[model samples]
Target chain A: MARLGRVLLLLTTCLGLLGTAGCGDDYDGLVIGVVLPMTGPQATYGEESWNGLQLAEADLRQAGTNIKFKLVLKDEKSTPQEAQTQAKTLMELEGAHVLLGSVASSNTKTIAGAAKENGTPCITPASTNDNLTTGNPWLSRICYKDSVQGGVLATFALSNGWKRAAVCVDNESDYSRGFADNFKGAFEAAGGTTHFEYFKAGNADYSNVIQGVADANPDVIFISGYYEDGGPMIKQAKARWEGKPVIGGDGLDSAEFLTLIGDAQNPIYFSTHFAPDAPDEPAVKAFAERYRERFGKEPGAMAALGYDVLFVLMDAAKRCANPKSAAELNTAIGATKNVKGITGLISLDNPDRTPNKPLVIVKVEGGAKKFHSTIKP
Target chain B: MLADVLLDGLGLGAIYAFIALGYTMVYGIIKLINFAHGEFFMVGAFVGYFALRDLGVDEVDLPQPLPILLAFLVAITLAATAAALLAVLTERLAYRPVRRAGRIAALLTAVGVSFFLQNLAVQVWGAGARAYPEPGIWLYVDDLPAKADADYKIRERVEAVVLKGDAIDTARKAALRAEGIERVYRTPDLTKEGKQGFVLLALLLWTPVLWWLVKRTRMGRAMRAVSEDADAARLMGININLIVAATFFLGAFVAGVGGVAYCATYGSVKPLTGWIPGLKAFIAAVIGGIGSIPGAIVGGLLLGVAEFAIPALLEQLGWADAKAFQDALAYVFLIIVLLVKPTGLLGKPQREKV
Candidate 1:
């Protein structure tokens, strides 16, 4: 019996070795790990971005690129812990050369950490929190940071002569707090007074906070929260503070927000990554048309950014001497400059690996998103 | 401004009261902390959503004010019945099996049921917030000179204006027409006072019914007897099972009503809708002395008012940023109440028979 057990253990060890070797086999292509919230609360954003990624992949193949690409998609389930686990699995198990994805900033932070630990290049299509890319070199995002949008809105508010602003910040969310802080700083610096009201995310009632804002009686109400809370808050606020131009960050970029407010005549404005209607650029128009045809739904900022993330990754890969090597891809991605993206001109030459891009300010008019203006950062 | 804050707080208080009543009553009778109680509130909200939006409650054509009033009544009845049935079902299947096992076992089972229902809701309805259809009611046109062109639209708009309790002059109507708006109706909108008024009215109507049920009815006496001592009450020829189910029915009924009020006030519902408010209501029950009926009401109102009012009061005191600690303040209130009155304000001291 002992002799048979030893033989069986030896056989199992040999099988494990062969499996490991097979996984480590080299492929002459870029293996991009795509982690996204294919389920859970942020599924809409994930599904749209995933569609965009697929379209980009097909387009790249049709356009005929020198470097071969292999994409592996994993569901992060709209959570930070899940995102981290999936990113690690994609890198260690699937032999991915680079990582992409995770729409939410909190989830992207975990992916960024995983990428840094594994010495792999990671880029996000949507996560806009400034701190995610501030110190991480391995991490790069196609979308502009929160500070840019905040500053742009503040400047825009100032230009509009909206002096007094009520900045409603969701204290539970890092994105909301950071965005509100940045806006408050920029707005106050330019001699505009801001009244701050705080709320937690996932709250159904904002009556107290709305009453506070109404009492403050600000010219513009800047909601620094996700659309889930922002929509209801704006609806409640409009009941009291009528005609107040409620401005928000890209967190309010969801079709559900328009539906939530339901055709109210409160001139709502939010700064987002892309506006398909404005500027009428041929590339953007074509991308929008293709997206509508493919998904049979209007493409939002996430879809546009997701489409750009791949092209930017490919652009960097084509420049690299060894496109499959993680280190080479990382270096090449950091050296990206002036790549024409559907959102805007993308560049990642900065040490922080953040691209300087223009943000589109869209307004909720007639229960639809209308392009108000674009702010160059 | 203070009135606005109070009214909003009262509106919130009504919701808390509905949920807290469930917790208090269940704990009062069974000594099982029904953690799944909140999920019933959530289920009721979803039921209300479906009833109003998909079930054709809004499609019933009636006279002015009759449609919306009928809609509210039908929706409330549907929600209450659904919640009551669910409560009874959970008790029969989950809680009853674990009843004699111990308090901890039953409590854990309650929690298990909560997770099950919440996940089930997610599966049934995707984990996204669905917009609650606006509940608007029309009123009779008091005295506006009706326009010949689009007279029905003008009357509808005038009815809406009248329901808002605002006398719109000819110039205002002309401005509205020029803006290309045809029909308007009264909703939680068109008022400085929030949805609290409607919620408060519901509470005022329901609390007395609840009071009469618990205090004045024959079943109320039997429930009180069973709560006092289930074995002794059973020996005395009271149907212990029937009383227990009735208690659950009453508690869940109010929770259902609260759900309707919640959606009507908040304008949206999701799978996880009941969790937070349920937690808050649980805290309210604890503060009010969990097993006491009056305790639940007082506790809920106090908690809700304090939650909204304290932040406003702090802002008045120039602590403009105190809203960040709004949720924290609720826990602190709970802790302080527990510390000062260990048995709660209205709870009787427990006596062990030697």
Candidate 2:
């Protein structure tokens, strides 16, 4: 185990070197430094986000673009405070012209301030808080807002003729709380009765809530938490609910979720930014195929968005004459519109840089999540 | 709803009581808190998991009651043995040298050992919580597995093929959209009860067995004698060191049982699985009177009932929004105990001559 960890550390160091150093003498002078939670509670998201960038780099090289930018990666340790500290190091110490990522909405909020203060363009791949980009023009996100996510879920549930619903939300996280609150409002507004239970991340017991929800006996159970908490909760629920559908947001989208649930036959649905089963264009299909070949697993929504963030940044850079200037890069990022991505067409024309995109319902089939349907926003 | 909540609390409290046994027993024999007791619980859990899921029987091949019973026995025995050995090692290596180096030194070492073990588990398993095999009852129907190994294999194969599919997924998506959401109405509230009853029964069974060991066994007598006065007991040819080691072993054995029961109830295990639960159990031990076995059990049940039932009751009172505070409730109780009865519920007030 120690040896594996050492190897992983070595691999990370190598990847970091490859990202920051010019591959050859002809490499461009642009520097895009990324800060992500690579080693803490949110490590999986960071690893996936990094893979997305690698895949994006390969795609850019294949396109034969003359523009070359070195990448510098920093670990945020999955906390807003760490993100705040790391973002400064990336901008000042690493001489980063542009910044992207550091997942969770709270961390993105911190990065947002750093970008504004540093005058460097920062694009987040998957921070969904509605307030993330409210006043920070230097920041943008590839994913949809948490507010819209919950409403979309309510629409999906009501559309399916399921009137009664019971829910669980991870109140410790703003992302989970945002979606759960929004879903409750939307569901009730549409005249569906609902019951709500609450939990937090890092907690293992949900028996009390499970029993309470089981008694409520709704048509479906909505879990507004990440895969870590959602996975076991579903298993416990399945033992009682007897095949009831479990719905969640993009937070529930992880390969580990399947590992925890372990062959549960019950229907599990989650709303996500991207679906490998259905793509908006042929490029998406190609990207998915290449990602599978490279990583030995299908790319998740975060990876897809991470890939899109790169293109979005590149598109912004292509339009800029003075690409090396951080201020110029910031301006170019703000003007981004209709850049093609494997997830969808990237357009940051909205004032807060919110993307006008589609959301899909992914159903857990066998052990993998497959597209159930798409909702146009 | 109240009854269900109570059952849940009782079940959790039962786990706490078992873990608390280790804390209380060790403290009783030697005046140490054994901060690494929680890690011992975690270690025991992992050991049981390996024995049952990785060694004793395959999840698919197990034929109902027989395999489950066998697996449970194996899990119990293996976990207890590992925990006892771990306790002995920790005492010899980390505690023995610091035994006369002041209480604070031993306490610091205990904390360090706890952290070391947690990080070690994280390195071995990664940070993700691995799924524990489902309880035997969940799979059994008339003493036989409800699903065959072939069914499990096929499902795995189907998942693999679908995940790898670029062409097949497109075809499946078209079909999925048509039958998308199956319409169902509200289920009967009373129709489902959580599996806490099983935990209650399992825990209740351990009470008498532990009572027999403590009251009627030779080791238990030595343990009591040492607790009274180690120096005096040693002077009488009681082999004080052996008695202390035996106490640690017995305590850890109870902790091992606790670690196994906990994950079996929760459905998953992680490197830090026992951290919070073990902490709460220690609090339970304190409230029951830190060095008292009966105190630990009583304290554990009380803490469990409060943890589970408080949230349920609060939710009913329109304060369901207070879920985050439930974790803090145990600490609150701890503070209250310190203020009201420092000696604990079953503990006698200590008299210091100084």
Best by TM-score: 1
- For model 1, how does the per-residue alpha-carbon lDDT over B1-354 read when each residue is reduced to its tens digit? 677667777778778988999999999898989999999999999888888765544444565456777777888899988998999878877777667899999988899889878867876886777777665543333333354211122222232232233446677667666766544444433332445687888888888888899899999888889888889998999988788888888899899999988977787888778999999999888888889988888888888888888877887899857788999987887889889998877777777845
Q: What is the per-residue lDDT of model 2 for residues B247-310, given as tens digits with 9 covering 90 to 100?
A: 8888898889888878776767877787888888889999999988889999999998888776
- In Å, residue A6's CA in model 1 sits off its true spot by 41
Error of 2 at B53 (Å): 3.3
How does each model score on lDDT? 0.82, 0.78
Give DockQ per model, in order: 0.23, 0.25
lDDT of 1 by residue, A1-377 (tens): 43554475478679857743424247666789999997677777888898889889989999999887788888887889999998998889888999998898999999999999989999999988888987788999888888888899999899989999988887877788889999989999999999888888776988778877888888998999888888777766655777778889888887778768853556889999888887768898899899999888898888988899999999999998898788899999999999999999998998767888878899887567889898886
- B26, model 2: CA deviation in Å? 3.6
Question: Which of the CAPRI classes, incorrect, acceptable, medium or high, describes model 2?
Answer: acceptable
The TM-score between candidate 2 and the true structure equals: 0.82
Candidate 2's C-alpha runs over 4 A off are A1-29, A61-68, A262-265, A279-281, B29-35, B56-64, B83-109, B135-249, B314-325, B328-338
Task: Compose the digit string of candidate 2's lDDT tens values, residues A164-242.
Answer: 9998877678988888888999999999988887775666778766776787889888998888888888776655767
What is the i-RMS of every prediction? 9.6, 6.1
